[model samples]
Target chain A: EDQVTQSPEALRLQEGESSSLNCSYTVSGLRGLFWYRQDPGKGPEFLFTLYSAGEEKEKERLKATITKKESFLHITAPKPEDSATYLCAVQKNTGFQKLVFGTGTRLLVSP
Target chain B: EAGVVQSPRYKIIEKKQPVAFWCNPISGHNTLYWYRQNLGQGPELLIRYENEEAVDDSQLPKDRFSAERLKGVDSTLKIQPAELGDSAVYLCASSFGRGSYEQYFGPGTRLTVT
Candidate 1:
């Protein structure tokens, strides 16, 4: 079975503070790793997709990196607007290519 | 390009009642998906459609839920005799194709079953 686990269920950070959210996964063959940001009462917004172990992608103040068994979403100098629930999902190489998602990490950045 | 569109941003209905939600995927997108998200949890796939055909619906509760996509553009998900446990956010997403990894989502519809 494919499973994903995210650590630090909730995090609080001061403006300009930097922190990292973790996503660990176990799958038969990892096709891709995805990161999404969801605000209260809104659908998740696509952030980045990491395919290989050494791959990394960035957008504005957010950066995502992947490893053989895990992935990290690093928030640099975050702001209040960046506060949202960050979700991690993994896709397998076979089947319908459905995504297996973790519970997610809730982030609160105070200005 | 316009993103996915969903209707009835919020809905509240009594248990055992019927309800429906609609979605219009991005133009030219051939793959559409419906997902349910419980509070404090990630979204779970309910059904997936490639154009007008449903390619995956393994997790859907066929006993109460049904979905349809017509002309490969717009889709609807309906639930008959709703249950209190069905209260959650229904999200619609679309991608260029089944092989596309990135899915753009719409503002979900919040359903409340009392």
Candidate 2:
């Protein structure tokens, strides 16, 4: 079965603190890995998509990197505005484009 | 361009009642998806539509859940005789095409069943 697991269910960081969230997956074949940010009472906002190992993408203070077994979302100098639940999902190469998501990591950046 | 739009931001109802959520995908997007997100969990895909055809609905509970994407644009997801376990946020997403990797999401409709 394909499964995604995110580590550190919750993380509280001070403003400007840098950290990384981990998402490990076990799947038969991986087509893509996605990262999203979700605020309270809101749907997830697309962040990045990593297609292969050693792939990296960035937007503002966020950077995402992927490997064969896991992916990481690294936040640099995070602000309170960046606080939200970070979700990681994987798309399999099984013809269909269904995404299997992880439980997500709740990130809180306090000033 | 406007993002995916969902109506009725919140709904509270007693168990066994019927409920429906609406979604309008981004303009020109040919792929639409409906997802259910429980508290403390990630969104799970319930159904997916390509144009006006439902190509994927393996996860949808057909016994009580139904969805339609008429005219290949806006869509609706209906739950009949809703159960307490059905209380969750219904999120709608859209991608440019079938092979697109990035999907834009809507605000979602939060449902609470007592």
Candidate 3:
């Protein structure tokens, strides 16, 4: 069975604080790992996609790194606007378009 | 280019009632998806469409849920005799192609069953 688990269900960080959210997965064959940011009353916005172990991607103050069994979303110098629920998902190599998502990590960055 | 669009941002209804949600995927996108998201949880895939054909719907509850992508451009998800547990946000997303493509999501429709 393929499953995704995200750690630290909720985190409260002061402005400019740095932290990392974790996503552990168990899949038949790893195809792709995705990161998204969702705000209240809105949909999730696409962040990054990591395909292989040791792969990393960055956008603005956010960076995402992946390993064989897990992934990490590192927030550097986060701002109030960076507060949102971060979701991590994985797609299997079976050519199916469906994505298995984690429970997500709620992040609140206060000024 | 406009992102995925969904109608009726919020809806409230009684149990056993029928309701429908609409989605217009991004122009030229060949793949569309419908997902249900409960509060405090991530979105779960209900159905996925490739062009006008439904390629994956194993997670959809066929007894009460049905979906259609008429022209492969827009789609609709309907729930007949909705239940109290069906209250959740219905999200629509689209991707240009199949494997490994990034998906863009809509604002989502929040459904509340009383």
Candidate 4:
């Protein structure tokens, strides 16, 4: 069965502290791995999509890197506003090509 | 351009009551999706539409849940006799193509089952 699992269910960080979130996935063929940030009561905002192993994408303070079996989102100096739930989703090569998501990692960046 | 838009930002209704939510995707987007998000979890796809045809809805609890996207533009999701466990945020999103590009999400409708 295809599934995604994220580690450290919750994390608390002081302002300007850096951290990393991990997302491990098991699937037949991983088409793409996606990262998203969601605030309370709002929809998730797309962050980045990693299509192949050894690929990486960065935006400001957030960086996403992908490996053959998993991915990691590294936050370089987080801020209070960066506090939110970070979700990991995988697009499998199954016929449907739908996304399978993990429960996510709740990140609280306090000032 | 504006992003995907969903109405009824929040709703509170008694159990077993019927309710409906609407969504308007970004203009010219060819694919639309509806997802259910429970607290502390990521969104789960309920249905996905390519144009006006529902390509995938196997996860949708069709017995009481119904959705439609007429004219291939706007869409609506309805649930009758909602259960307590049904309290969740309903999110709508659209992409320029069917998963061929990044998706744009709406604010979502937070439904409360009291």
TM-score of each: 0.99, 0.98, 0.98, 0.97
* Native A-B interface contacts kept, per candidate: 0.84, 0.87, 0.84, 0.84
lDDT tens per residue, model 1, B54-74: 999999999999999999999
Clashing pairs in 3: none
What are the clashing pairs of model 4? none
Q: Model 1: which residue pairs collide? A: none
- Interface RMSD over true interface Cα atoms for each candidate: 0.6, 0.5, 0.7, 1.2
Model 3 chain A: weakest 10-residue lDDT segment is A90-99
Query: Any idea how many clashes model 3 has?
Result: 0
What is the full ranking by TM-score, best candidate first? Answer: 1, 2, 3, 4
Q: Decide which is better by TM-score, 1 or 4.
A: 1
In the order shown, the chain A TM-scores of the predictions are 0.99, 0.98, 0.97, 0.98
Model 3 off-target regions past 4 Å? none
Worst 10 residues of 2 chain B by lDDT: B95-104
Winning model by DockQ? 2
What does candidate 4's lDDT look like per residue over A10-59, in tens digits?
99999998999999999898889999998887899999999999999999
DockQ: which is higher, 1 or 4?
A: 1
Candidate scoring better on lDDT of 2 and 4: 2
TM-score of chain B of each: 0.98, 0.98, 0.98, 0.97
At residue B59, give the lDDT of candidate 4: 92
Distance from true position, residue B22, model 4, in Å? 0.1
